[model samples]
Target chain A: MSKLASMLSTIMILFPGVAMATPDIIRQQLPQSVPHYWKWGSLFVNLQVNYFKVFFLVALLAIIIIEFLHFVIIGPKKFRESGKKIRVYNLFVRIVHWTAALSFTLLVPTGLIIVFSKFFGGDGFVRAMRSLHFIGAILFAISVVPLFFMWVLHMLPEEGDIRWFMVGGGYLTKKEVETGAGRFNPGQKIWFWIATVFGTLLFLTGFLMYLRKPNFVIPFVKYQIDALRLAAITHNLIAVIVLIMFLVHLYMSLFAVKGSLKSMITGYKDEEELKYMHSSFYEKIKHKLNE
Target chain B: MYKYSRMKFYCDENRCINCHGCEVACQVGNDLPVDIARRKVITFNEGIEGKEYSLSISCMHCTDAPCAQVCPVQCFYIREDGIVLHDKDKCIGCGYCLYACPFGAPQFPKDGAFGTRGVMDKCTMCAGGPAPTFSEKEKRLYGQNRIAEGKVPLCAAMCSTNALIVGDAEHVSQIIRERRMAHGHGVLDETPYGWDIAYPNE
Candidate 1:
């Protein structure tokens, strides 16, 4: 009897419906053929419960520590303000970039709070953070379209991209090195695509998760897919990638390249910076500057 | 002998008639919102001959409750009797519990902008929350503390066919064993539905 009971328990554990059948309605509602525990559900739970907070902390710490070391060792690139400022960004571009920046500023912190909700211990504060996250999503939705359209042309791959990567975009040395980079460096271009493309995916998955019961049906699929579970898994995975890239982008603009933040704020780039950081674009536009 | 008594809920598929009495009883007893369902009656192979069966499902209040494991705020607490309860005030309404729950027990009110989730509400097994027993605050937030009054959960109490039963884990299993034996089944072999997931150690 014990052997039989053990065998039955094993079967039930291995195949959920083998010992005591699951209701058809429950089956239809939460289709088991899709492998909820092994495939997606456990993965989502593990990522959310175990890894997300640590992942965010480690990523942030790694970036901060690495950037600190870089600043101490290699140092920030110092460029002489030649008093000749070129209007690199117009009013429209500045507005759009800041709008996206503000959204990211809101989104990233609130997202971290949500991940580390245990530390906050929930309540009105954490709840407020959740609401703030939604607000950030709305801001991102408004800014992302214009941000993409305005810079996509300049962000595309160019012959200079290879040279920029090979020389590490002159970031390793304090001395200025001519990197054949365009108006936007390869680093900037990569950040652009990740923010726009992966940001879109994040928004979509987040929306599905917000809905909680998307119940989306694929035409050819045999079993009903758990859309919310998939959304959650994809959202967390994409979030990690976006978060790391956002940090790098932040470090690059705010600290690594001195005066980079000022360029965005004042809508002007120093002539010296344009010469060394964007040598290829400087070559093309230098005549216009002289004229 | 067990060190501590574990409370559990069991729904007999053979006896359940799909009347949805438990669902209605729970809602009415708890004064639950229309959007929130603490208990649900699901039927298998409806309109089919010889293959039809029904059962009630809610928070299994698992020994290793997954919702508690996944809750970001650590609001969930399992009672000495193994009743899983959570502090509503501490919930941030993130809805992680919903994803982790195998039985889809967690329900959220659409209270936020764009129909985003409010705080989670689930079956408390009539044990209420961390609030003081029978306090007005407990009643206001978590509905009745029926367990504190030594009453069966409203769902089981009102189960028309006595299909849904709840009590000490040992007693529940004993009843199930007798029922199986009386039905000409010599020995209990198969685990009760959801037991493998909810109480794997049992």
Candidate 2:
């Protein structure tokens, strides 16, 4: 079969509900794509759009409120002495982190507008949103490349992660908790890995979704409709999960954890700040301080 | 008052030969760029005996068209005559309609890899879009607004086998019913898009 033949075959299979002339012959053949799986398709449509949107917004808001209160009640962690600063993050790392942050902030709103602003936005807004999304996607792709490589080694699951996770990464308890945290706690490690893995997946899926026309089906690349549908489903699902994690991440670093946001910005953390929160990391790097 | 007839397209599988006449005529009539086809014919059960069947699939122009429902730009409109039309100027070519549409009616000019492509182009059901009816601008963006000239679509008119039928849903339904009854099949009622979705009220 030709590439087009394969594509059309996939399309025909996806649309078995409409095709298949005789209603008498029961279609025992299962649909390959997620959308064509009987009521499963409609369920996905509702879940992917509505639940994803509601959950994302509600979780973000809830995280904000909780993090705000946590910050107020606990207050920022401060050492009595003017502590020496350790060069934890390099300048390049800070630049990449800010690039990721700025792109994400821009991306989230633009994505929400594109996905959820149907009832209100006109054609002009739609065009604008799409163009903006395309631009954001490029920046995001660039940021992801650097962030993935920069953080992958730092995010390796450590021996102390089990204790860190068991103690809820020192977040649940107000009493001084021995998290045995590295430069990043287990939670941050999880977020870093998820961000890289799922972020890469989103890019791949979004890339496939961007490709729309039938003419795109080259000989080597069998760009079938069913594959497109699958990619779209995965993209939406991954996006929702990633967004929730992102909100949680943003709150923890910026609002919940004191002095951490400054470290990300300045590539330096107070020596006492590191000793208090991340002793394991400080011990590892203390030998380098004398050099 | 809702006076205009509800329009529809019905394909009698029994008569269809999978000949690309309707497809060709539509492309020529529209002067559509090579990448896009406003109409197409698809076949199933190839090489298999008895089960081999084909259907001429294009925009059925549903009353509560999902294309209209899902369009981020709200580019589509259903005329009183039930023709589904879209404003090209408004379409950003995000290709949501292609995802939403069951018939796969929406086609874009650039169908290759990499970045964004051209604006969306799809079946206008012989009726031009939001641009002043029968105007040259409509013709330039969309193709001929032939429905305004009291003529059927070029594809339906050019179908040599008379397999692809286009008209008011009721009349077309009657023709299909009569044909089916003559062939000894029971009278199976057909709903023109919206009834299945909004059945009781519809």
Off by over 4 Å in 2: A1-44, A48-50, A71-81, A95-99, A119-124, A142-146, A162-179, A213-223, A257-259, A286-291, B1-5, B48-53, B73-75, B87-90, B111-114, B180-202
Compose the digit string of candidate 2's lDDT tens values, residues A1-291. 556654564355324242222211111111122124223334444554446557656766786777778777875454434468878789898888888787777677777676665554545666666667766777888898899888888888787778777777677656666677887888788788777788888877776666453323433422255445556667767877777778888877776667778888888788776665676787788898868
Candidate with top TM-score is: 1
Docking class of 1: acceptable
What lDDT, from 0 to 1, does candidate 1 have?
Answer: 0.82
Model 2 Cα lDDT, one tens digit per residue, B95-159: 66765554557777652223365578888877877889878888887888888899998989998
RMSD of 2: 7.2
Q: Candidate 2 clashing pairs? A: A216-B111
lDDT of 1 at B22: 92
Score residue A105 of candidate 2 by CA lDDT. Answer: 77
